[model samples]
Target: MSDNLKVVENATCTFCGCVCDDMNLTVDVDEHRITKAENACILGKAWFREHGIEQRPFALIDGHEATTEAGVEEAAQILARARFPMIYGLSDTTCEAQRVAVGLADMLGGTIDTTTSVCHGPSGIAFQGVGESTASLGELKNRADMIVFWGGNPAEAHPRLFSRYAVTPKGMYIPNGRKDRTIVLVDVRRTASTPAADIFVQVKPRSDFEVLWALRALVKGRKVDPSIERRTGVSLAVLEDLVARMKRCNYGAFLFGMGLTMNRGRHFNSAALLALATDLNQFTHWVAKPVRGHGNVTGADNVVSWQTGFPFGVNFSRGYPRFNPGEFTTVDVLARGDADAALIIASDPASNFPKPAIEHLKRIPVIVLDPKATLTSRLARVAFTTATYGINVTGTVYRMDDVALTLRPAFPSPYPSDEQVLTAIRDRVRVLLGGNRLPAGAAPIAPAVAAAS
Candidate 1:
């Protein structure tokens, strides 16, 4: 350790989608490691402290250690030779790397999707169906007087959400902060976040759609069956009171999470909640936002939406972008054995995906690019041990509330960044597939690169 350490202020922490940007990092220049991270959450501190351990080969091909160039070239050859290829996992990387991935899909005439396809894909589908009424965290901090947490355990997942933005933050309109806010938690069971709520509504599991639909009907001044209480485990009186209070609030916000999106009804559950939020806006200022899970999943959605004209589950097989969630999503594509080759970056589907999908993924030629070794890397044909995003490379990432913040690197990285590796692969694949030019009718990648910059 050096006596003189490097100090980096205002470095963004990319652990979760919160993107907390006030961290002060102390870096050991000689060791190229983060010694301390001030003003960081537990997750951020753990993520920062674990950087700069690059003991294995920076790149591997067919389980053999290889140079980065040879690995990229082998990966390019595999992707260029494949008839059906799919690229996945941009939630943990920067928009620059994500753009390169989209371009690679275009050049290979394949498909490109993100990690959001597994977690919040249904929310994106519902957003397209009913449109989202969302506001940035700053707006929530300043004006929201009533906050609802539906099926989200922010206390455990997003520890700083309450203190930094939602419930406890002191803003111009919220002079008393938590005292002036009415916090409600709606989940199938009690969670760590329940203690922070002024009121907790525990509904029956697998009945969120029914409850949300009944609430929407109640909000719209329509009569609902009294048996909803028995079906959803929420009394009629409580539902009536909740709806009445929602209408009375000056500003209300509903922050839902995977509880709604990952359930039986999936997209319909999210659509019902979003429609309820929109209906409430008729009487008061109300909005709804999905509680995204990963660090840059929101940014991945933004980049994919603006670049490919769709959110997740986008396909470029016909030399143009086409989207269909269940059909083109990564899990479904692998489960159906549609993708002959897979390029996974910063995600480990092998560990989390269904057995069928994992089986099919194992059968394919998989290329993995990640900072840490994971289960997916063990089965990959080519693996690139890349640098962690915020610790070793700078990029723009959108917070959970869709607020974009520029990340600053705290120290030097021993390995290449995702952008550098993906760009090198994209160029190599393009040359191997055909000329350096993109196929006809393919969307230009320069615009996406420009937007990311």
Candidate 2:
């Protein structure tokens, strides 16, 4: 530390899918805090306001405190004894950690996925069924003549997204960014994202799949009554107008969020969106990207797809990776009370899961590794606190579109990294599985990473 040496503030916005790269940060080294952040969103501001060191690490078991090493050892024992295991949660950590997690799932003969099953699980299904047509944010900013936000309100979820990338700011191809693009919003209610759009089509709740089907019918030239409305409350005229725009645009992109994927129809709704994107390709170029919530959820999907030849919901119980969504997913397994050990990394299922699932988690020997004290960590038999991926460590993350971007740490911490803890567990598993006196009486492992691979 020098008397007059100015600290440089550099960071990428982790608040949304846009992943805004240029934000000016001012730090107070004396207090170890951020003083000012320029060109960021409201969400970003709120996120930075709390540097969040007050969240001390704790190891709890049966609603009481336990030793950290004891917690890890107990968690390892649980995993070692189970016939079926689940290594879930990767929304808040680095892609590097995500990669390690999937690898661990492969080695453990278990399943690995995120909470996306509740959010964009449907979208992923649609993607696997009929691949999405999507583009980079840079491409949207510069070249897209039309942008349709379906089942998403980026104005609130991603505050700086429109201002910095898609609608407002200038770009290479479209100089006067927003003025050059036609923005349309489609939702059941008038939320914040509706006001900014040039056209807003209000549909009824839970009819997104039907609406998409009707739109596809129109695109394909089959006739339909203009007066008949479906569950979404959107009219044929409105659908026609939107269809026209899809035909007229030089290039377009549809950005959807949790609204489309998380409700009654779930993955079927997501599959419709994917089908609509494919239908649009018949007339012109149209793409869709799920407005994923976590900074690197897509990173989890990509890593799993590359390693296991499928995304999430993978089971290796037979010593080989096998993919199944509903049967092998986290919620179903938890509900069935089948898995003996659960490793929750960077997630809070206690808060986010259904009561049955959370109850199952409470009954089992659970291991949680996170950066903060959440309900999930509080219930874990072995809880380990690790550095925040985007805030305290540096690694790559994937936006919803599968674009890899680096996450820069704004500060440092005393906690060991997520990778360190997982690697330790991995080594412990190797020793325990070797069956040579158990390295202090731990259980044995079946196979290592090489055999699993």
Candidate 3:
């Protein structure tokens, strides 16, 4: 390795929600690529390697190449002129950027939502309904004798979850690591993580809430109907045995994912899981955590909560923060044709969102800020390819367990950070709005003055 090459130690990998912060990355400054990444999983390696790629133009305005300033100006004009606008996709960016997005939405008196609305929004709702008993990953690794993975497959999605957190890692209380812990996996079918499970409970599809409710009944000493086995696909004897061990375990942890949040029951399923964890606390120490998807979606939720007083699906059109899922959420907002323009950052909703939402994006003026050209960018009237966070920009991100971690960049980036661009646009909008503050601590926008006009 040449002296010109820079090595970043203890660098964080912002690929999955795991947020593994033990990577040692070697970046070739001249080539602007990561040459080597030690202690990184496949996903983390890919995330770092892709940071050096800049195949797309720096910025684009209606399919034409433009400077960064021109792109910001156009984005500001679009938001300032719109009656209703939305700012979405903060899951992949830093908390600093997410804060600016919230401020931008307040200024526009528009709606703002994170990708969490699609993934873990139900979990957030459930937490509000029935408060959960939760702990950090370190607690599970150290003190948990029984580790449960429900509706989530950590093997494929979070590659290092087991090795770094629960099953394989050695800790103070679990000195023998895997030998000291009993891993349980509950899903509709066997997954890659099933092979490592000491117990596998296969339930019927969309029956997770039922199974959880049954377990809660069992924990509460209520006699559950024997027919629950037929409905859930898990035998009665299996349920009884599982509940017995759960009560006997020194410390148990239930880690659930989208299976519980996205299915028919939605927030009710998550509520049942959390309720079960709380119920088990009477017999033994227990905790539950939602398996977050993206690297910084948890951070997005946190920043939005602290800044806007809500998690996701927040609306400011009333000049005050109001949250109502399924109504104020991104998908519903777009599907209802409530938003005339959108400012999307670090997310590709056009490809990932439902068909109706994508159709709406096609008709509206869309602004996208991302490092890569995504399907959403193709439809964007103004798209600016920005730097990848955690690799090229330094900021704070929250782990799935709500642990805050500061991210350091391994290499400098040519593109401006999302915070810089959003701040510039906000400043420009401030000027365009005649420099008066709005009701929601936002700069006033001169009505009827169109940016594209």
TM-score, predicted candidate 1 vs. hidden true structure:
0.95
Better structure of 2 and 3 per TM-score: 3
In candidate 3, where is summed lDDT lowest over 10 consecutive residues? 436-445
Cα RMSD (Å) per model?
A: 4.0, 4.9, 5.7
Q: Whole-model lDDT, candidate 2?
A: 0.76
The best candidate in terms of lDDT: 3
State the C-alpha lDDT per candidate. Answer: 0.89, 0.76, 0.91
- Model 1 Cα lDDT, one tens digit per residue, 365-388: 999999988999999999999988
Flag the better candidate by lDDT, 1 or 2.
1
* Model 3 vs. true fold: TM: 0.95
Clashes of each: 0, 8, 0
